[model samples]
Structures are given as C-alpha cells and as structure tokens.
Target: MTQSGEVTTLKGESTDQIFNLKREASIYYSDSLSTFNDIKSAFIKSAGNSSLQMVFLLKGKLNGYLTGSKKACLTFAEQQHNILLINEKLQLQIKTETHEAIFIRIDPAFLSMYIPADHLGYLNLKDGMQKNEPALFSGCNLHMTSEIAAILNALRTSEHTGFCGKLFLESKILELLVLQLSQFELRKDDPAVRQLKEEELDKMHEVKEFLMNNMNQQFSLRSLAHMVGTNEFNLKRDFKLAFGTTVFGYLTDYKMTLAKRMLIEKDVTIAEVSEKTGYKYATHFSSAFKKYFGYLPNKIKSGKLSLLILIEDFSVVFENFVTMIP
Candidate 1:
C-alpha cells in the first residue's frame, strides 16, 4: 500500500483501488469502462466479520444475486446508495457494465463506540445484526445528495499522505456513515411511517410524483391528501415517514435541484428559472437558492466557484438551512 493507504491494481480494462483505514474500516473503489462485448461478472464472498457495508454506485449498473437465492438480491444503478449489515457468510454474483462504485466495510463495534446504545439507529442495527441475516439499513435505495457526492469526491481524490491521510480518510468515512444513520433514524422513529400499509405507501409515492411533476404549482396539505385519496393528517404524517421530509420540504428541494440545472444553461435567466420553479419573484428564488446551496445562482453561471469550495460551503451550512425551510 502507498503512504496514502491506497493499493491499486489494474486488470484488463478495469482498475480497483483499496484503502485500509485504521484497521476497522476499508474502502474499495472500482472503475470498469468496457463495452457490452467486454462485460464481466464478479463473485464476492463476504468475510462474515459482522461489518456494516455501504455501497455507492456512481455510474452505470450492477445486478447481483445471493448464492442460495434464485432471484437477484442486489440491483444498483448510477447515483444510488445502499447500506447492509453482513454478519454471516454469504456469496454474491455481480454482473457489471461500464460503472464506477465505492464500497465501504466498517466494523459495527467501531461504530458502537461512537453511537450510544440508547440511540434508535444503533438499537435497530443491533437487533438486525443479532438475527444473523443480511440486514438492510435503508427501506429503499437512497438517491445521492450533493453532500454525499462531495464527500465521495473527496475520498476519491484525497492528496494527504501518511498518518494525516489516514486520519482524513477515517473522518470522511465516519461522516458519511453518520449521514446514512441519521436518515435511517429519522424514518425508524416515525411510527406513522412504520404503520403505513402498502397502499398508503403507494399514495405517498404518488404524492411525491405529483409534486415533482408540478413544480410550477403549489399544493396545500389538504389538497395533496385529497388528490391522493387520503386525509390530510395521514398524508402529512406518512409523507414524512415515506420520504423523510414534509410535502413542501420535498417540493422546495426539487425546485432547488431543478433551478440549479436550469441556471447552468447560459441562456436561462434567473427570472425565467424562478418562474419555472413556482417562485413568483426572482429575488425570492435567489434567496431560497442561496439558502439551499450556500451560493447565489450567479456563481454557477459565472463559473467562479470551484466544486470543492461550493461543497465546503454547502456542508458547513446545509444542516442549518434545512431546518430553516418549511
């Protein structure tokens, strides 16, 4: 391994890099850029060390099945993340196309040291680990957030060396894990979400789709609930459980994401983008954009801020900003 704790190997058209961090955590990154004719299958057998495994697929697709299961147990695509607790020996067959992914294996005991036993996330994880079955931390595949993307980018391009490098890498890994756990905790603590029937969950998804498709419009809790054939209270409660955010909260994030993409096009003005995202005034849209992204839309248009700087600013302010939003 290099002083940066990375060991790299190249086989055929693929490159794999492994970083061992503090003996309790390790990171595996793979990039495969091959045509359909050169596709490959990889078989992975778990070490059965009771570690928590987090996987992030940045590009392309991966499909896999367990050793005993006839059906595919794993399917990952670009911009998706999943967390699993591996406590027993298991084998997986994975087929990959042109893709880049990062896998992190962290000892649960190491996490326990940082997370209190009374914590809902730790308790849920502990219960799952004791069952001796592969446990999923997320109910559904999580879409990668800008914050997560930033941290992953840092991990991929780290420049620090030796002990300092190890420390930096460890800290980043822990930060990423904490973010995942917090999301799980939020959903787990929501009893309304836990009690949701399949039909109710479907309604929540429908609500989300409607909000996303109608960004140029606004809906109150009662109107959305009515449209989904549910009551306002159930809609408000279950929506948070299903998506980890309020109806309006989700809409605000969607609008901000769409606005950012629109701002990147040179011909799109702030006023036009604001209108597209349901903001009556450009100033209101700019204020919300700055709050969500920690920078004005003009910074993106001007190309003045580097991605690293934007990430740093966003990370510092995102938590506080989210709470300020409705």
Candidate 2:
C-alpha cells in the first residue's frame, strides 16, 4: 500500500492518513481531536470524478453538507455507514471533535472490473455507479453489521507491509463492498419494498434516535408511528424496509443489548438493570435475558462468562433472534 504521512490542521490536532491501495482505489483514515470547546468546521475536497465513496464513522459525531447544498446537511453517528456517488467536485464541512472514521473511494471503472456484466442486475449499486447516477443510499444510514465491523477492524489494524499489505487491503475492500451491496440485493426482488423518500428516511432515523434515547420508556407501534408523524401501516412497512426490522423488534434487540452491556460493565444489580432497560419485573428481565443470551444476567456479573464468549454466544443467539423475528 502506498501510504502518506499524517498531516495536522489548524482547527485542532487532527491526523489524516491516506492509503492508496491501487491507482483506482484509496482509503482515507482520519482522527480528529479538537482542543477548543466551540464547534469547528472544515472543507474537504474529493480527488476523483464519478467515484463511489463510502464513509464509515466508528466513533463520535460528524456533520457535513455538500459544497453547494448547505440546506441538506448530514449527520453521521458512530457505527453508521453513508455511501454517496461523487460526480463532481465534492466538499464536506466537518465538525471538529474527537472522532475516528474511515473513508473509502473507488473509481467506477475499477469497481466494474470485478463485477461481471451478467451479474450486474443483482447489484443495483454497481449499475447506478456505472451510470453516474445518485447513490441508492445517498442520505440513508445503514447499520454496520458484525461481519463488516470485523473486516474494518482488520483493515485498520493489519500489520503486513509492502505488497502483501496492498493485496490484503484491496481484498478486504472488495469484501466490504460485496457485503454492503448484498444488503441492497436482499430487497431487490421483494415487491413490498419501495424507495423511501428523503423525508420518510429521516423520519425513520428520528424514530430510531427516539428509541435509543428513551430506552426505559415503553412505546407501542401506534405511539411510535404517531410520534414520527406517520401512521402505523406506513411506519411498519417503511421502517422494515429502511432498517430491516419491525419497530418493536428493534426496540427489544436494543434493550437486550443495552441490558447485556450494563450487566457486563456496570456494577449494578439485575433489578436495577431491568428497571433501567424498561423491564417491569426483574424476573421477566432475567427470563428475556436468558432467552436472548442463553444465560441469565447474573452469569455476566458473576464472571462465569468472558467477554469473548459473550460475543460469540451473542452472534449465534442474534442469528436465531433475527430469524425468529418474522
């Protein structure tokens, strides 16, 4: 990999490292640690035309807008992926804070080399990029999966150098692209799925934020739909299309995940964790936890299960959880 040394900026002590995997593909890893209390912004320039850019925010919050379109500012949070098609010169206004992110840029022609024309129909993103069309997920925030997260961590922490490193990075990038594109493929043949408008997508995200912030509060489908200015039917349909989960399903997963984290990290009792996670009764919470993780919450607190074992168990249990959802 062709690597560049880190460069510091004036707004704060930030380091940006660029890795040119090949002539047509590159990766930009950025770490920004702002010193001032006030929010700062910066303009970023894109190098290639008609390139597909994927932004993965691993930590902190980032807000930006295209150079000419200040009205449509975008906010990206941790573990969110935003894919965009850059047909012209693109500039980003970044907020200065303690943040870490990875930006991958791929030339359409280079990406097309790997995807056979006959199979292109299955990959909507490839076809769109080839035509210089707007990205299908331009304003949407796709949740990062565990598999994608593992690849990203490898890409960031790989120790191989020289040609071996270049090969490793390129292969990982293609693997990442395949995983991301496969998500879109899942809905390609589903007639129930429809393209969500920007407003509707924003509403879906708003509902997600509301759930994450108010985890202790119980919400019905009707209440959440009304809270986001949509009806239950559309909310149920569009939310599933947008986030790949039913409304309450996402809530249950979120609560269970939070409960697990609390059990492992916080020195709190099962009852406290249960109350904090919106459970009416500790017994009910323990039952749900056991069902979700294949073990009771006390096991986590008692040090019977290690973190690695918990992660592996959660993966298996989550697969069962998702499959049992519908």
Best of the candidates, TM-score: 1
* TM-score per model over all chains: 0.58, 0.53
Leading candidate by lDDT = 1
Model 2 Cα lDDT, one tens digit per residue, 56-107 = 8776666655556766455665656766654443344446556666666655
lDDT for model 2 comes to: 0.61
lDDT tens digits, residues 1-326, model 1?
A: 12222323111112222244334555666654432112222212324445576778776665555556777665664556777665434443335534667667666766666666776556666777787655666655565554576677666655555555555656676667666766665556656445456688679878877987787776688998999898999998887765566788777777876776566534688899989888899999999999997778887778654454435544644554355233
Model 1 weakest lDDT span, ten residues long? 9-18
Indicate the residue-level lDDT of 247 in model 1. 80
Give the clashing residue pairs of candidate 1, or none. none
